[model samples]
Target: MIFLKLFRESFLFAYDALRQNKLRTFLSLVGVTIGIFLIIFVFSAVDTLKNNLQKSVNKLGSNSIYIQKWPWVNNEDSPWWKYLQRPTPKLREFDELQKRSQTALAVSYEISIDNRIVKYQSHTVEGAQIDATSHDHDKTWNFDFEDGRYFTEMESRSGSPVTVIGHDIAADLFPDGGAVGKALKIMGRNVTVIGVFKKEGSDILGISDDKEILLSLNFAKNVIDVQNASYNPQIVVRGKNGLSDLEVESEVRGLMRSIRRLGPNNEDNFALNKTTILSNQLDIVFNVLTKVGGFIGLFSILVGGFGIANIMFVSVKERTNIIGIQKSLGSKNYFILLQFLIESIVLCVMGGLFGLGMVLAVAALVKAGTDVQIVLDIKNIIRGISYSIIIGMLSGIIPAYFAAKLDPVEAIRSN
Candidate 1:
């Protein structure tokens, strides 16, 4: 009952302080508000960007390995000419690995070609990303169709003039739906659309599935010079459910070495790259960003803590006579300390809430104006409040201690 009364009185005192000197209180807490805003905003943005990138990378494939002539990132230890001379993965190599690999659930290959124009009679859509893909490629991509079905294995092998259009292309060419079985001139060849990809909205990172069209490998070869090493045709393999990705990749690597006729003494010429490479790289970068953001926020928060401590000291000095009166009335030293501490904490909390509100407002504005999504999650909110409480307690400690230790006789005489 006593603690409750003390807390109530402290709350009123804190509220009255703010009410009496609104501008001064706001000015004092400005540091805390700015610091919290910076830290939370940065954390939220970095996390959202990381998630977006990971999602984009996932669209490439998960539990899937890419066998290519060149590594995803250039190797500093090896001569560039070594990789330059390596042969681009071929359909025959894909077939050999598919026949031999035990850990793989699906094996396929794809080659990206130059962007080309597509037309459906009068309606024309230009600069559509095209991929020439072999059998089981769609399985590796794991696309959920918006309309029609994936091309049959026979259609893929025989180099049938069929194309699977992305959502945007489908919309542009056949807005009324029923894009399947429609004859569209793609890259000067009339091909029937066999499948349409689901809608994936625009991304600032330029990673979107809605702008691509898939073609049969053989059909693409006939149209473009895919045999050129610069085209970078890659063989993709998916791991079995029970198998580890590394195990699948290892089996593929051994099969590839044998198929390439490389002896045990020779180094494996081709690179077996995983989609997780992009994710791992991005994680490292985000970790660095987190550290940088932390340090930058720390400096501002330190200043804010000092500002709060200064406010507590001034508040104690301003209310010294009140403290003496309470002590003379038989209030305990601990109670005086608790009251001042609670008051300081409440003030800090008010500032923290304002800071969080500002962040949420900016987050909403960003979401409304841009494709980038900034989320102020529950975890962040809790963290902000916790920081506020801790800072408040630390800042108030000295002032609360001094107020508690003051001699009631001297304090009352001075006032």
Candidate 2:
């Protein structure tokens, strides 16, 4: 009951002080408000970037591994020249892996084709990325169609000129919504649009189905030399549902070595890449960015802490007479200390809340104006509030102790 009465009295006194010195109070809190905003804003931006990059990684199939001539990251031991001399994954190797591997649920061969003009009567979308893949491409890759369906097994084997277009391609060529069944000229060859890919917006790694056109590898072989090094051929293998990625990777690595006829002593020519490599690289990058952001934000928070300390000192000086009167009324020393400390905490919390509001407002504005997403999750909110409380306690402790130690007669006479 005594503590509650002391709290109520302290809060009323703080409120009165604010009402009487509005400008002074606002000025004192500006540092704290700005500090909290900087810290939270930086954290939110890092989180958003990390999330977007992870989404891009997911689109690449987390459980799938790639067999390619070149490694995603250069291997210091093998070097780029050695990787260059390695043969690209071929259809024969893809077939051998599919036949031999027990851990692989699906195996696919894909080749990249340079930007080509795609035209549907009067409409044309230039510089569209084109890729050709084998029968199990849909199983190896993760995607959804906005319309129609994937290539039938017969269509993939027979080199049928059916194609699946991305969202942007469909939007540009068939504005009226009937993209399926229409013929579009790609690489000067007429191909029927069998399906439309669901819209997936671009990510940091430039991975999205929104700007691609997919066709069967057999059909591409008829038009161009898929075995050519310029086409960048690769094999993708997705693991079975119950198997771990390591288990699948081990089997695939051994199969590739056997298929290439590499002796036990000879180094493996092909590189096996996983989404986890990219994810680990991203983790390193984001961790550094987060630390740098926090380091810069702490300087501002330190300045704000000093400003709060100065305010607490001023508050103590102004309320000396009140402290003496409370002491004379039999109020304990801890009560005076706790009352001042709580008032400081309340003030800093109010400032932190204002800063958090500003962050929310900016995040909403940015989301409305841009394609990028900003996440101000519950963890960040709690972190901001916790920082405020710690700063308030640190700033008020010394001043609160001085207020508690003042002699009643001296404090009362000071006024």
Best-fitting candidate, scored by TM-score: 2
- Residue 291 lDDT in model 2? 83
The residue-by-residue lDDT of candidate 2 on 1-415, one tens digit each, is: 9778877876776677668878878887787888788788888988898888878767777789999888787545758888878888887898899899999899999988867889999999988889999999888888899999999999999999999999999999999999999999998899999999999887778888888999999999889998888989999999999888899899998999999999999998998999888888878888888887777666666677777778778888998998899899987899889988887877777779988999999998998888677988789889988888888888788989999999998999989
Off by over 4 Å in 1: 75-78, 175-178, 202-206
Q: Compared with the true structure, what per-residue lDDT tens digits does model 1 show for residues 1-415?
A: 9888988998898898888878877787887777777778778877787778767666766688988887877556867898888888877888888898888888888887655788998998877788888778877776778888888888887899998889999889887889999999988899999888888776534667688888988888787876667566888998888777788888888898899899989998999888677677778888888778767766666677788788788888888998899899998999999999998888888878888889889988888887557856788778777888888898888999999999999878867
Query: Which pairs clash (backbone N, Cα, C closer than 3 Å) in model 1?
Result: none
Runs in model 2 lying further than 4 Å from the true structure:
1-9, 12-27, 75-78
TM-score of 2: 0.94
TM-score of each: 0.93, 0.94
- Superposition error at 25 for model 1 (Å): 2.1
Q: Name the top lDDT candidate.
A: 2
